[model samples]
Target: MSNDNHITIYEHEILRIDRGEKRVSVNQLKALQEFYGESGVPYYSLIHNGVKFCEYVGVLQVGDTLIEILPKVDKNLTDSEASWRKVLIDMLHAVGLFNLQAPSSSNLKLNSNSILDLYFELFVKEVKYLLRQGLVKKYRKTEGNSTSLKGSLKFGKHISQNLVHQERFYIQHTVYDTTHELHAILYKVLKLLLRINTNQSIQGSLKSLELEFPEMPDLKITEATFNRLHLNRKTQGYHNAIEIARMLLLNYHPDVSKGSNHILALMFDMNLLWEQFVYVSLRKFKKGNTTITAQNTRNFWKTSKGSKSRMKPDIVLNIDKADCVVIDTKWKNIKNYNPSPEDLRQMFAYMKYYKAKKVALIYPGTDFSNSSGFYYDHDKYGAHEIGKEECSVISLPYNTDIRQWQKQIALDIYNWVEVNDESSVDC
Candidate 1:
């Protein structure tokens, strides 16, 4: 590679010179060579921050002072990869990056934000319990002094001389106080900061691995295939990479704060999204398959007249090849909260425009019209509605029993795709 490809090295203190040799890894050496050059020595340049002393030199040694390199100033960083980066970090932590198997008694402790998030989760659980117990109720006395009405009766209770019939009660638990809201904001920010780095690493690794191992390769079942299989094992198991990097960060930078500023903070932390994407992508890849996401939109205009109003579809199937169909994931249950006309219309539009033979609007529940391992189809609009079409609003119960939602999310995506693929037909 040339000097153009060299990775610039930045000192901990901006533009500071390292007076002594520092041990560098083989990989780090390679990275530096690629950024600078084998023969070019690094030197301080006040105007450019740092530059090569000369072209085409030899390997660098310790005590060979190099000025810190400076990166270009970024102004629109709020709109940049910072958001996705946070998500990447979080994913890494979730997937065994943070000494996952170490004894709980280990001296390692989570940052303040992690502790705050833990507390917030606990707080939510407490609120749910309090709600279940019902809110405070007020009691009142009713008339009836024949026997002195020994104990007071509740309001709306008809007292017959001395005896009381029943009690009427009122309860209220919908409290959104400052304390609760603050906790929620704090929890979200902390969670985002914690997970973003891991998420990015997972995504970068997955993409790189996929490019190297195409799904539909034509090959004979021979030694080459066996070697490739072993390589796949190493590539998929990125636990070592995650652990090493995490250990380095935790050991070197113990004072860094891990918290997000706002919702955009979550965007910078792509850990959750990376996990969701990689899990879905790789599982399909492993099975020599492809997947798609569904898109939905609504319009109240005829095809010829354009639209008087518009409604965006909840989801659309974006996959290109293979049997085409559309499906959407909903965290809500369909039974308790029936789909509205808008929801049905949106789904129908997706089916009509996408030319999909079957459309599934999946909800998080185990109930449907037919069997439990369920599958069903219906044309709900009865041919009179503006955007009526064939649709299957199936309820697939989420495995809530699983303690780790991330693992369960991957499993759910794989199982759903496997069972519902067009080839299966019976899903």
Candidate 2:
């Protein structure tokens, strides 16, 4: 995964990817515009003679170039792309999105060019592992013209074709082999990698895998095609390879008009990733008798004669059996600005519904410190008075050591939750 064909940009960044003998070529730009036009600007918006990346942070591949979009928090922190790229990969790994193998994950996170490249390398490894195990074979029904009769015979066609000779019979027979639907899907993904993979370091491995794998018929694949595949206990080892194949196959969008400028985008929403990352971090390093649940829902509003609406918070921390803290994660830097009225109101609503004394909005804080304050209520006459419930703003620290960063987030959350402990009984 070299930087020769890779381009890294931050979130909300704009670049003029024009046609020329430059880093991003004209064909690549055309492919990108086509993808953007079809995809409706989910990753980046198509602007005037350039592209403006949105809030999504992930790898997108068009033609032979790899575009790595990352999350940007501080504008003044002059850090290398390798550093942010490592952070992005670390976050993805923490949340169980990227299943990077050992030694390569630890040893080469810095050297990896983009998320997709790392993923392609992992796929190569999985295919190699399956190769080592020797592909599984199953009994499948196939039709062929044979001199020796087997199974059911196509009598009408056999009599017409072999009328004079009357020896060869077009028969449908059962044969146990590897040319099944699973192999067909895997072969398709391998062929796709051969055409789209730009990482030169692993070109040999891809070709080797393509050669080793038995050629399978081109299939019209869909979601149901994979859902219909059946795997036995003996073939359970294909789980990982199949999972990655599912992702790649489902996300692949081929060019119908030109067919050569196809785009394979593997992008993820930063907002959802951040929420899952925070929830996973807290759950991983939580204290005793504490539980963390994500997307916990509660019915809040309902029509008189219609279905009820639910209010789902990103995270809810419970102690024993009682809800303790309602936490909301935001993938933004909340430095030098107050929380918005909408966010505060949402937190308040969560506190009221979940019966949690405190609600916190967690942000990726590279520069902000944690702060907690009480909500205000109308006093006895008409003045404003401090309320009982607490609203805290917590910012988690960042570090190259991803585990340590997760642990720090857990520590900060626990400390903030117990800042004003009322039941302080010595253990």
Candidate 3:
């Protein structure tokens, strides 16, 4: 089906709208429904003051405009209709979408005889009601003293208490300052529209190249082209994903719930960026005499039989000459000032079991304020005495993408291997 012939359905009916050059076509109706047919109790409407307004309908249009009375609601019970329209109008005005223009003489003439005449009439009635409310303040100020009156701004500054101020009266009726609120809301909407447009443009470009120039060589980004990609600024996905990850990582807050345990598990499991870094970094260690194995070695040794003491580090890079250097990737940093005894003992046990001298804990750099590497020497049984200089703790910043980090990790491992070949492998 042609995308153009869509009908917008609202409240299970087609809301005929003014589409300017576009017809009140079924396609437009469908598009309208998909875009703005939000279902809920109406919150604002045009009413002729307190009188039950039974006529007039509201239809939302593209670009933050609405056509009232153009496609009116045909049948309506009085009380419900009045309340619905009231909410609809108020909401539109609140959101700065209502920009009603005075009807021209010809328009009024047509409106008078039209089937939706009552809708127009009801709209005017509500406008008049507002006008009455506006006038009430104007006259009340003229008669009453302004000192004690708190309703309007004039009263706020006055010595006498009788008059209310116009400014305050206006403020009371508004959801937000219309001018400033419109500027922010419109800017936000435009930004979102631009992002979606960019995505569509990129897809279209790729399709065109495939169809018209299939044999052409693939597009390669040169230094000049590299500048065009603009990878510096954070993308929408980055911000959203990071925020979600941060919340889950800090699940220590009692009020911050992650829904079901299964959902929380999945949420943490989606730490793609963190996982990428860990795996790529491990690749480097494998290139030099050491082979890195995943899920083959336990992170922690089982202290007691039947006790689930095995710890599976994301990836373990074994040094071909000696024990393995263990590393773990964590999205969140260990916030406690001191590492838990269990964790320290686990790393120690890992060093003993794997018979590796070096160990490192990798955490996302964004989560930590400080970066420092340390060495621990426990010579209680001459353990550290035997290899006092071999065991070290390294803290590396997690920045660049996985590929870049992987290369760096490989270089670091190669350097370590070169320096170690001349020294004793065991303590």
Candidate 4:
């Protein structure tokens, strides 16, 4: 209920506290229940009067109303107060949230002095970008009584209202509309963020944005609407900003009755986030004639006479029209640079099915020595006489410098694939 008790946590991180230490109030419990009912997953579990909070990873948001947990700050906290700003930008960019054409500048730092400051910064930036290019407009259908019959006549309404003899005609007009659904979403995000962010500067920026754009009733942005969004040359500049705005709106769970203070905080799942980041980076830096597929699951193997399971690898690399590599990213820290038995078996199955000569298991962390990479001979690893296939474990440290990390990953991928270039194995 208070800022002192609120703790910031990262995705997949658990928080447990005893009743005597910090008990969940009845109102907060109700809010949690409502959240679970809507999301079908409990944000926090209760055990014997103690609270075990589970924060979902992916995007960042505030969950102050339902729980006392906040987003975890970087372990190595800095005095500059802008340490996490670059990381946030890189994460957003990896997920295709930023326009590639937009100019990159370090001046675009976040005001992350507080829990929701980063979010506020992104919100303001998006609003300013949209304004610079102007808001998108479309023609919406309008219906009412008018002197001119511009569209189809509503004969039933005219007769029922006893205005048939009058000069007024029930008609419809397709007027050019400026208050499009996208603008409505933008307006909603600004309004919600403004309410939670106590920073006066952010609040003032939001107010200016609101005045520039027409006000519309808050609308829910669903997957359907997101898919339906289209862009042409005129509206292309707003594409990235619109996507960021949509993500902001999707994570927002606003309370209709209580207003902005009761809005559910935004958070992103770290596992999925890491996977996506890898996929995006690989695709972005892929070499010529190399095609990478994320979560490719078209192929399947029959388990029984009537049952079969799909083989959906995290990433499938097709080089020069051949299935060359099967790479799976692991977010966990590998102990002693040794992958678990289960992971080995999974990789083996993938190698056999894809007929890939090389399989790389990518992990996070930089402490491991890069000089001696983990490699296993297929015969020694229970491959029998199925020729010599190689499986290696590579460490990809999560660096705040996104460009450098991506470049290293791209180079690593190229080297791994080229290792088997001499063999000429066809799939």
The numbered model that scores best in TM-score is: 2
Name the regions of candidate 1 deviating beyond 4 angstroms: 1-287, 293-318, 366-389, 400-427
Write model 1 residue lDDT over 1-427, tens digit each, in one string: 1121222232121221233232333433333333343554233112122223221111122112111222111222232222222233344444433333333213333331222222223322332332333422223333332322234433333333213423322222232222322122223323323443222323343343334321332222322322333213323332232223222222221112222211110111122233343344333344344454423354546666764666443344334433455655443444645556565565566656666645565554443321112122445534433222345555543322322334544445445544543322122
Tens digit per residue, CA lDDT, model 2, 57-172? 88877666677888866766777778888888899888987766443233334356677877777778777777777988989998878989889998887887788877788899
RMSD of each: 28.6, 4.3, 29.4, 5.7
Any runs in candidate 2 off by more than 4 Å, and if so which? Answer: 1-4, 17-27, 101-110, 229-232, 319-323, 378-383, 421-427
How do the residues 214-304 of candidate 3 rate in per-residue lDDT, one tens digit apiece?
A: 1322232233432333222322212222222223222211112332111111011213334444564555345635677654455453455
| lDDT for residue 184 in candidate 3, whole number 0-100 | 25
TM-score for all predictions?
Answer: 0.29, 0.90, 0.30, 0.74
Candidate 3 deviant stretches above 4 angstroms: 1-276, 284-286, 298-308, 319-323, 332-342, 366-391, 398-402, 416-427
The sequence of per-residue lDDT tens digits that candidate 4 reaches over residues 341-420 is 78767877887788776777777665432322323454566743434556667676556678877777777767767764
Ranking of all predicted structures according to TM-score, beginning with the best and ending with the worst: 2, 4, 3, 1
Clashing residue pairs in all predictions, respectively, total: 55, 0, 39, 10
lDDT (Cα) of model 4: 0.61
Better model by lDDT: candidate 2 vs candidate 3: 2
Query: Model 4, poorest ten-residue lDDT window?
Result: 65-74
